[model samples]
Target: MTVLVFLDPAFADGRIVDAGKPALMATDQGATRGDGIFESMLAVDGKPRKIHRHLDRLASSAQSLELTIPEPEVWQRAIATALAAFADDGGGGAAGGGGGGAAGGAEAVVKLVVTRGVEGSSAPTAWVQVSLPPEAGRLQRENGIDVLLLDRGYDSTVAERAPWLLLGAKTLSYAVNMAALRHAHSNGADDVIFTSSDGRVLEGPTSSVLLAHAEGEGGTRVRRLITPALDSGILPGTSQSALFGAAKAAGWELGYGPLVPEDLFDADAVWLISSIRLLAPVNHIDGREIGTSDVRAALTAELNELIAAT
Candidate 1:
């Protein structure tokens, strides 16, 4: 199987050749040990959606870690060029031609990973890699996904203790994140949601949670879309942002605040959003059946419209 990867420096050859060895520094080999940042992005219609936002987040993460990155234009060009090649090779296709059968009809996932450049014996290596297209993100969106709540928390205290905790940064060190997802799969769930040891809902292992308002308060009826607050220590979700905007444009009220497990059940709708999954309507949580609520149809319609417009 040929693996499609974006070389940091552009290359013409599609196949991986010994001459195209990655310029990996010693620091990237195993010098520094801590959280490394990373970002997962998606390509729609053969183009990345909100590319600047993802890049902005990447730059911020690097800055927080005191690491430098290629200029925005350089990075953008590298990614764009690679995607164009892939799209030509059946990844997506020339833009505006429907790009059919290319990773779910011109929709693909592009992941960006950057590490701190080697700094002395104590510095970690800096590197970046972009995946061709993520099939998993596509699968989850097509078919509803099941999620299990892990009692383990991301250690909120670490965010302050190690300012470079990489939680906010899109670091490269993601062994724990991968392990959490595996843990969920091993337990019969398609994905995992992290929660505080004390039962405070955090986020999914790879997506953000959006809860629907079940009841209106103070004579103001809450509409369809809702999510946890940014201060709640959740990874800001790109798809959720788009969904919120769509809901608002369609006259739906979107709320953001802290929510509990009970809130998930009480919510008119519950979804896990991310670059890949887009929006996955959760059918069940734990062993209980959700989506039986009154707002199920409205919420489903709202999600369908959002996808159609996109």
Candidate 2:
């Protein structure tokens, strides 16, 4: 089941629409040209996780695109309305095994979208969608995944030189991104981590690249977290950012990098993280095993605890 809520000034709490009906126009730029920005968030027990972070990123993207969007409060109200509708019996009989919006099993994927609007129209189209989180993401988080490295066809510094590329924004234009994933699937891999033309590690098609390092066996161990630099033409992951804060508080050293494939190969553990998926360990890269499974599992568990707390 799914729910849709449109942000409208006339409706103080936002307007809940029929998810089954056609809500968007065929000529809408978002539908025709993918001229929009979006953010996917996780809501558990009716509470959205890292909402501020997601909103901030969305605002940043909108600003970069010079597209006017609804205020944060409007989006918040729409999100609440959508979630409530999703929990209602009309949408689905409770989210999961747990009661509607219950803490244990009830979880939803909340998506916020803002389009450039119908061609030549003055108003932009914005809405909130709520649905169940994918079971595949949960499986990947638990059982791990296999990734293939693919070139993103641009230099790492290109975004800095050409702001028109919109590399840092999380927009609705994801054709090539989806194509990359299909390519990985055809090659018997679960996902793709893009590298720059210069061989600098970038990010996954729909996630951020994360590598961990650990030393000193059990008790006195020192663990460090590393991710590619934000300026490396990759979308800044809300989950990865939140996890870094939590990990740092728990004594994990952190580093940002202009990392390369060799760095991923040498890390203690590797993962592809995003808002919806949370965290999924990378067990193999191009058929080459990464780190030790024991170490990877241990670190994954430790970090997942941190993610849950977030």
Candidate 3:
């Protein structure tokens, strides 16, 4: 089941709409031209986690597109309305939305989207969507995943050179990202990690790339975490940011990168982190296994605990 709440001024708490029915305008630029911004977040026990961070990123994305979105209060009200409606409407009953069922925690995907609205309109069309997360994501978290490296056809320096590319925004223009994932599936891989044309590891199509390194063991052990630089034309991942904070407090070192594919291969462990999927460990990159079974298991367990603590 899905719950949708439109951000309408006429309704102080926003307006709930039938998700099974048509709601968006056919002429909306967000649909026709992909002129929109969106953010996905996780909700547990009926409360959205890292909400302010998601909202902050949403604001950043809207500003990049020159879009005017409602204030944070409006979004918060709408999300609240959607969650309440979801519970009352029997949408996710006991197992999907708020801390029950098989995915371990009561979890849901809360997505905020704002389109450029109808062609002649000056106002944006904004809404909040809440629904169950896909099971494949949970499976990947437990079992890990195999990945293929794909070229994104851009150099590492493109972000500063081309602002119009909207490299740092979480926009609705996802055709290429989807296509890359499909290409990976067709090639018999579970996912993809994109590299820059100049050979820098960028990110995954729908997630951020993360790698971990552990030196020594037991009493002398030191753990380190690394991800690509923010200037590498990738959307800043909320999950990565939260996990880094949690990891740092747990005494793990943190680093940024203009990382190369070799960095991924040499790391003690690798993962693709995102909002909905959380963290997924990478078992293989281009058919060569990464890390050892024991190391991967230990690191995955440690990081997952950190993420949960966040």
Q: Which residue runs of candidate 2 sit more than 4 Å off their true CA positions?
A: 90-104
Ranking by TM-score: 3, 2, 1
**Worst 10-residue lDDT window, candidate 3:** 95-104
- Which tens-of-lDDT digit does each residue in 135-238 have in candidate 3? 78888887889999999999999999999999999999999999999999999899999999999999999999999999998889999999999899999999
Collision pairs in model 3: 99-106
Candidate 2: give its CA RMSD in angstroms. Answer: 2.1
State candidate 1's TM-score: 0.79
lDDT of 3 at 263: 95
> Candidate 1 regions off by >4 Å?
1-35, 94-104, 118-132, 154-162, 214-222, 293-298, 307-310
TM-score of each: 0.79, 0.96, 0.97
lDDT of 2 at 82: 86
Residue-level lDDT tens digits of model 1 in 18-132: 2146555555522365445667776766677777778888878778777656667766666666566655556564343233321245666666655554555444333333344
Candidate 2 lDDT score relative to the true structure: 0.89
Top candidate on TM-score is 3
Candidates 1 and 2, the one with greater TM-score: 2
Predicted candidate 2 versus true structure: per-residue lDDT over 1-310, tens digit per residue: 7788988889978998898999999989999999999999988767788999999999999999999999999899889888887877443344361332212346788999999999989799999999887778877887899999999999999999998899999999999999999999999999999999999999999999999999997689899999999998999999889999999999999999999999999998999999877789999999999999999998998998888877
Error of 1 at 250 (Å): 1.8
lDDT of each: 0.63, 0.89, 0.91
lDDT of 1 at 287: 65
Please give me the total number of clashing residue pairs in predicted model 3.
1
